[model samples]
Target: MSSIARRAAAAAATGLTGAVALAVTLTGVPSALGATTGTASLGALRASTEVAVAAHGVNKEGYEGDEAPAGVDVHQEVSTAQLVEAADSVQDPAATGTSGTRTGIGCSGDGTSGNRVQAVYVGVAGQNDRYDAVVGALRAYTAGVDGVYLASAMEHGGRRQIRWVHDSSCQVVVDHVVLNPSDVASFGAERSALVAKGYDRGDRKYLLYTDAAVLCGVANVFTDTSPLQSNANNGGYAQYARVDAPCWAPQDHSVEAHELTHTLGAVLSFAPHATANGHCTDESDVMCYVDGSGVVMTQSCPTTHEKLLDCGGDDYFNTNPAPGSALATNWNAANSSFLFDPPAPTATLSYDGSAAVLAPSVPSGQGWRVDWTAPGCTPATATTTSPGGARLAVSCPSGGTVTATLTQQDGRTAQASTAASASGTPAPASSAAPTPTPGATANPGPSVAPTAPATTPVATLALGLTTVTPKTVAGTRVVLTGTATTGTAPAAGTRVALQRKQGTGWTTLGWARTSAQGTVSLTVAPVATTAYRLAAGTTTSAALTVTVTPKVQVSASGLTVKGAVRPAAKGTRVALVQHGRAVATTRTDAAGRFVLTAPRSGSGYAVTVAAQPIAQLALSAR
Candidate 1:
């Protein structure tokens, strides 16, 4: 059967006939399910098929080949280290010190970079805050394909991040382009909107991440009748790709990377294992279509290879291809300019009035060091070190030009100086946003030059008692508000950081620039009872503890009651209390799930985890 007919039969068998939209595979073929391609009017495309969320248990979306691919002996099984690395890739840790603003409002890349994958989150207008999940998925996908982390556009502080169209107030701007319920499968509509928004640069490979429940993922493949050199097929043919929210996981054949692989010119028609379109017939390969091609897919590599590119290394991406080999002669993805191993380790030193904090960007297996000199400070000169340490803080009140030299274990050295200044009175809150403080400077990376002169005195900044509100359950965000002052005057434009107590030192969670009135309001999501403080330079607010209790999810089935607690820890006690008494008690299992026999006569029951109040649920006696 043809790919379209097969898709229709499957959709009908699964009762997903009307709900199925156009399936655009790597070949850019618009499935018979009703999608028009290449200069066809979009109105006809939208009218041809209904866009409904697929409720089938099986995910029928993604590449078109056939059957389960067979696993092979040569493919490496996933190691614990690889799993950990994959997990780390998706983690979005809070930023330290003052948060820097970016030029773009809602997206993550500047069109200037050479052949970079622009991370984009097509969130609903006026209703998103840096879709952290999308960012995490992109990071994970990039990390898995290449050892190096994906590079992003630099913000004000030299931090690489996603960019989208936003106004001066930092609100996302979507130009009447709807991709959610309406244009979910209208790839052309999305492409047009992005192009109108100045995202049509030929050098960029735009990774459009959307919450839309469209097809699993889709991208246009650039290919020819024969194998060509990697340089000849490098770019510009296909630039934008979509990875719907459903397929963002790194495990689903590394969906984002797989779609991107298509745009990167993989599995040429001339390749030995190439399928009709741009997919290979090899099993355990990310670019191999698992379903519709005439050739049945069989894994020639281990199952772990599903998260990788070419299976045998002879197809499209062998780093060191043998001479006269297909990969050596044709377009190779491993040689793409967009991919690279992680760069050398480097650190930055910045003195924010009250203290000098050294931040390092160290690659794997590398250590960092910081040596400083500030004559008037306590212990004028000292050295601090840590094994791949995240940050090091030093107390230096006499600012002036505080200089610090950082050396990586390999002996690569970089020096930076911050001209710290004394605290000044904050201007009254104005209708306008305060000028953003110049980002900290370092010799090794991009930095905004410090504004203060070298001879400026040390700042004596202090924070007032902070106030927190609305004690919340786990997974909810909380707000902390306070003000910074220089003596009795407001210290406007000073950078204030929110820090959490960890061990003996305070770890910076997130930071923001003080308002014109010197007030700062920071938001954080604490999973457990956490001690937090506000800091400006070395001065800090009184420690305030925010209490967070584990949230419980309870459901009743027949005579049995089952529930789970977030942050599931094995051995945590849970009790279903009735009339201020424990009626049923159980300990959470490793999955944080628990079960208890419902009392035969219970009408109202309160569930508690570790003696903390949870939601009240009514268990009906059947």
Candidate 2:
């Protein structure tokens, strides 16, 4: 065989498990294939190889004129045993079932909230058919990334799933972005076209699945390379990732995942085993770089782990890193908000006449509890006994106010309330006293009537319950809003106090009066996890918990990294992190201040404060 063909064979056997095979034939020139016996079948492969070579200088010979150095082809295919072991490491699906094929693309996670990764079908303007042939495969591919074993009878690990954009039917949502192929001939052009179509947003990571075969795939790797600023700002690059049609097939799942990981900020250039181009040098890992043209690759993890990320769990994507590990201190792709576990249990209250129904949105038979109070009645509690997102009913006889407080399994609490007038009718007006005629009061004989003593009218008040806008913060401010009502009417001008639970007692933090619309708002910056509620006179709303993550303010001059933690307390641990590695550690003095000197790596730095325990009162009771 020719030297080029020999290299091609080795690349197919060792480089990205299935990518090189799509780019080259085992016994052909690296750049192009001559007319062969199976000319018809090889036509598409030939065209793809030419595009990859012309666009990326990627082929069996090497990358950009660089030949593969000796001993570089060390990676091998993963074995069945290793695959089984990796599968065994995953958490079992809490429920037993397989999801049906998702037909259409929709928003991520119920389409309403959270950071999302939207899939876009970018095609040549004239192409018809929304690439429907590959949609199922793409979804299955995503499931595999979340640790599902494709060969198994039932899927598992609803524990972690790609937060893909999906429609109301639960089918994957893939938006169409058709452009003239000429306009997006390069990766930069592709991104520009997407931006021109208004795909740029901080909350989204756009995954572009293109029908064009310009190159295998490419993505922008946004990193924070500043010495002083927090690397958390790198979230601005959540906008783009692309997979070319030629780079993937129904049987190949890793390429799209490979490209998507780049958008999630993986394999930083400073990673312990990463190449100069931000790919790991370790083999048997999805994010590893084994193209044979750059840094020498090592077969550190067995080939079975080729489909997994961070084979050793130290480089980029560890779900739970050991204390003081690189992933524990720096950026970890697993921590990306684009991936999510099953949602937390939730309950919402709605009214059905005099009955207030507490409806829980949770998995079937998940345990839940609720405590409620009705007007002119003592508090009552109930728990779910059957299955599904069950509903509990509370009766309110007087129709003044009813509040239901729900408790999640993890002890978090949420409250809902409703107000309605009894009988849907207005109260009768009090009768006025009879006036005496001008001079007719002198008849004080036997038939005179006596007057009854006057009585004052009483009013009932209700406080509308709402949680903080952001239930969690990193030393930032959160806005709390509430509404007050007096017997089914807006309680305008009602004085309300914002109180935080403090050691079994409530402390007033701020006070405000209800607006003309009965709305009240308070902005607070809490340094620790705390329970808060709104109170008007003797009536208090249900508690809301706001969790605070310690924020580390970092500034570096020369080799010194100095920072302070908010809610400053003595002995707060601080670490200087860079390139997915923590290089220095120190403890704050009495003022929550700390300083450490680190070697200049020019790739930027991040300050991470060790998690400090904070006292919190449980907002939920059994």
Worst 10 residues of 1 by lDDT: 6-15
The reply for model 1, stretches above 4 Å from the true place, is 1-259, 267-457, 463-467, 496-511, 525-527, 533-543, 551-573, 579-581, 586-596, 602-605, 615-622
Model 1, 146-209: lDDT tens per residue? 3211211111111222222322322233223333444343455566656556665545566676
TM-scores, each model vs. reference: 0.50, 0.39
For model 1 the TM-score comes to 0.50
Output the lDDT of residue 515, model 1: 86
lDDT of 2 by residue, 281-321 (tens): 66766666544455577777766555556767777766666
Quantify all predictions' global Cα lDDT against the true fold.
0.48, 0.48
**Candidate 1, position 122, lDDT:** 73
Clash counts per candidate, in order, are: 18, 12
